[model samples]
Target: MAARKRKQSPQHEDQREKVRFYPAWCKRCGNCAAFCPQHVIEMDQWGYPHAVRTHDCISCHMCEKLCPDFAVTVGEETPSSVSRRGAAGPSPGTEGSLVSQDHSPERLAKTPHPDEEEHD
Candidate 1:
């Protein structure tokens, strides 16, 4: 039997404010979907959350606060209005750590494999 393709909602330009999802960093924890008051976010076939109802978003920042992975960002679409979490990385006091604090000798001894490179 052939593998069935997952159905994804068709993309559209609704002129709503911006909501960004960093899939690489997303852990698919579903907290964003569970906490959204407007029911805007929906889990994709792979269990990652996507903004299915972008127009309904009210910039409540609930998803921003609830995400343990720091994957979702809610902000307005303006030159001045940048990421809810600063452009560099997650803001202070977020659920996840911006940098890994494990500084044990074992951790410091580990090194990345030569063949592997970080993705963009």
Candidate 2:
């Protein structure tokens, strides 16, 4: 008998906004899928969660927080009114998120440090 391949949802997109799954670290606890309000994620035969309706995701990060093993990560969701793609990384849930900050050498160097000044 030939080895059977897992059939997955065909509507997958290559966009940055997605529910990332780390199988190696996953314990298949099903917490993520059950807590999802949008019902974007679904468990397969082996109890592994997969983002089936990624477009419907609100980037709530509910799944990410519910996971006990940190097996899931919800990618940043971009709205039509705003575009975080221009920034360094994905849009964070908060304005002060570190992902939106520019950590480049030039930006870091420009930042002032009180301790760097001579106390004498």
Candidate 3:
């Protein structure tokens, strides 16, 4: 007998997932937060990052490529994309650094990367 194909869920859809943030590596920098045109990112009480409006994310990869700590990641939420970009890559603020850390959250509740659960 032939087996039937499994049905896919809405969560499995390619465009449903939003960019991911790596809290451990994040230096609390506001690069990704500032670069995001969608304003999807938001700052926590302690000055950490959080994805307040994930659905608004446009997958522009601006936050990913601009993150100084490689803390912000983008693209489909599939295992393949994670593995491809998760590998050991040069840390942010290096030659390919997309954003600078000049702004401070103390002055304002600057945007932050989601997934960074830390308070500050």
Per-residue lDDT of 1-120 in model 2, one digit per residue for the tens?
111232334554653347766544456688998989888788876575777766667789999998997657677443421232232222222354343223353443344445445642
Q: Taking the tens digit of each residue's C-alpha lDDT, what string does model 1 give over 68-88?
A: 876677874543234322322
Stretches of candidate 3 off by over 4 Å are 1-17, 78-120
Per TM-score, what order, best first?
1, 3, 2
lDDT of 3 by residue, 13-88 (tens): 5434466665446677888778778877777654656676665666788888888776676765555334434322
- Note the residue pairs that clash in candidate 3: 46-120, 49-113, 51-114, 68-92
Off by over 4 Å in 1: 1-17, 77-120
Which lDDT value does model 2 have at 105? Answer: 32
What is the C-alpha local distance difference test score of each model? 0.58, 0.58, 0.57
Supply the global lDDT for candidate 2.
0.58
How well does each candidate superpose onto the true structure, as a TM-score?
Answer: 0.52, 0.51, 0.51
Instruction: Name the best candidate (by TM-score).
Output: 1
